[model samples]
Target: MKDTTIDDISLISIPKIKEVRGNLGVIEGDVIPFEIKRVYYLYDVPSDAQRGGHAHKELYQFLIPLSGSFDIKLHDGINKKTIHLNKPDKGLLLVPGIWREMDNFSSGAVCLVLASQKFNEADYIRDFKTFKSFKR
Candidate 1:
């Protein structure tokens, strides 16, 4: 098996109002390019927290740090990449067949995730050794 990485992270920013009684804007079909099927958030986690120790066979995910910062370790079977997510406007788009681990969360960090598919336990590859053998 090999260390894996995929290029799917993309930065997204939406204009927000800074004052009371101020108008906000929404660009139709511009921000959030994906059709979201589910919305979730990971919060109230301590420092050195670790999540997502599996690979999806047929699901897509977009991860964003809502409050603080964290590190995303991504693998795709042949390469590995670590991304530092600090800003709220930036998100990582994780495609299928990529293993990801979310760790090194700062205090009061809130992670927002959008999914393209529903939850399926069979779609997860949990064993790292099995993932090693799953490469092309």
Candidate 2:
């Protein structure tokens, strides 16, 4: 069974250390549930462009907006949610089997992603209908 409901999605708060010079954000092993196997980022997005029109079979991802802002639309078989990411110290945790689409990126927005697995095309459900069937 490769499925998790939308309720499984969660918000994660990264620990921040304040300083006079600059504030530092931390994403230690304890801050996230999984051992991150990959790190990537999306930037320089056009305002009308969108991303992530897919779902994973068994991958978990944590997405953070390092700069500017963006909106992520998530959907389960029966439920849907939209989340806005703006702060650098906050992130969204996406469990497996949930559909996700990203859009409305502010100029210079940088979306950092921490994944539990390395890039694998076989793990992705790129079609919404297939994703819905998978969730069942």
Candidate 3:
């Protein structure tokens, strides 16, 4: 596995169409680097609850806060970063080999995740100690 640093993380601007009555958000074309193969979302999470405590070996992910806000803590075995996401038109691009933890969600916050790969158990590094010792 490649040792992707926290500096590799980027915020992508999802396209938006402003209208008099309402606005529309689009995520097609090359907005996301990977071809989305799986889509999932987290909703109705408690404010004190936490999620995502693992790293992917070879998967790309784009995270968007569809409603409310939350904080994502990323680690790359050597570096760390904290990103607060709250906008609908903004998305965070996470490459492979980074440890991510999501928490501090506002009430009724919905986190939408677009994945480049399907669910694969072998592609995940669930333990932090193993993540630090296994991959480089």
Candidate 4:
């Protein structure tokens, strides 16, 4: 597994075009670090609820908050960081091998995740212990 750190994470700004009707944000394949293969979103989370308590072995992800706000706690076995997501035109880029936990979700917060790979159960490391071992 790769040794990831907070430095590897970046806040990407999506292109926004302002119009009289409304504003639009565009995300193209070349805009991000990796090509997106899967797309998913989390919504309807309770204020006290949390999500994403796992690490990926090879998959990369980009997280964006479509509405409200939330915090994503990332641990790379050696370092940890907390990132807040609230803007629709910004996203958090998460590299592989970093364990992550999403929490502090406000009511009606919608988190959109763009993945570099398709869903594979084996790619997930759900246990902190196992994820730490992979870091070593």
- Model 3, range 61-94, lDDT digits (tens) per residue? 9999999999999999988889999999999999
Candidate 4 lDDT at 25 equals 90
- Residue 76, candidate 1: Cα error in Å is 1.2
For all candidates, the clash counts are 9, 0, 0, 0
Q: Model 4: per-residue lDDT, tens digit, 40-85?
A: 9999988888798999999999999999999999999889999999
TM-score of 4: 0.96
After TM-score superposition, the amount by which residue 114's alpha carbon in candidate 4 deviates from its true location, in angstroms, is: 0.7
Alpha-carbon runs more than 4 Å astray in model 4: none
TM-score of each: 0.81, 0.97, 0.97, 0.96
Instruction: Evaluate all candidate structures by whole-model CA lDDT and list the values in order.
Output: 0.76, 0.93, 0.94, 0.91
Better of 1 and 4 by TM-score: 4
CA shift at 94, candidate 1, in angstroms?
0.8
Stretches > 4 Å off in candidate 3: none
What order do you get sorting by lDDT, best first? 3, 2, 4, 1
lDDT of 1 by residue, 1-136 (tens): 1333575545556455556875453323646666788889999888867988998877777777878998988787777888898867567777778888889989989998888777889888999878777766
Candidate 2 lDDT, tens digit per residue, 9-114? 9999999999999999999968989999999999999999999999999999999999999999999888889999999999999999889999999999999999
Residue 121's lDDT in candidate 2: 97
